[model samples]
Target: MRLIKAARALAGASQDELAQEAGVSRQIVIRVEAADETVTVDAVEKVRAALERRSVVFIPSTAERGPGVALSKTG
Candidate 1:
């Protein structure tokens, strides 16, 4: 999904980096991001956790705006 790509970008990570962090293959990340394959919830969770670790937060869509990602503020 676009959110995944946005989150990765916000994290300043490549697909390979995210795959490594998520404990999945680069191919898996490709497939997931392409939105052409069905991935397991666990796999999705792994990707989310990896992104979260990098301070990438996923925000659900609101009527005013579509779903998006943002980097967490740091002191």
Candidate 2:
């Protein structure tokens, strides 16, 4: 998803770094970011969690705006 790439960029992390953080392979991150339908929900969730752990907050899309990411202000 766009948010994944954005989050990674915001975190200043490489795919390898994110994969290590998520406990998944770099290929998994690539697949998920590519929006490959075959990628499992679990893999996607792991990637999301990894980003969250780095303070990347995922904002859900609303009628007025599309989904987005933000860095958390908290510790």
Tens-digit lDDT track of model 1 for 1-75: 878888899899999999999999998888778765588878888988999999998889998999988999960
The lDDT per prediction is 0.87, 0.93
Model 1, position 11: C-alpha lDDT score:
97
Please list all clashing residue pairs in model 2, or write none if there are none: none
> Which candidate tops lDDT?
2
- Residue-level lDDT tens digits of model 2 in 1-75: 877999999888999999999999999999988889999999999999999999999999999999999899993
- Poorly placed runs, candidate 1 (over 4 Å): none
Where in model 2 is the C-alpha error above 4 Å?
Answer: none
TM-score, every prediction? 0.91, 0.96
RMSD of each: 1.4, 0.7
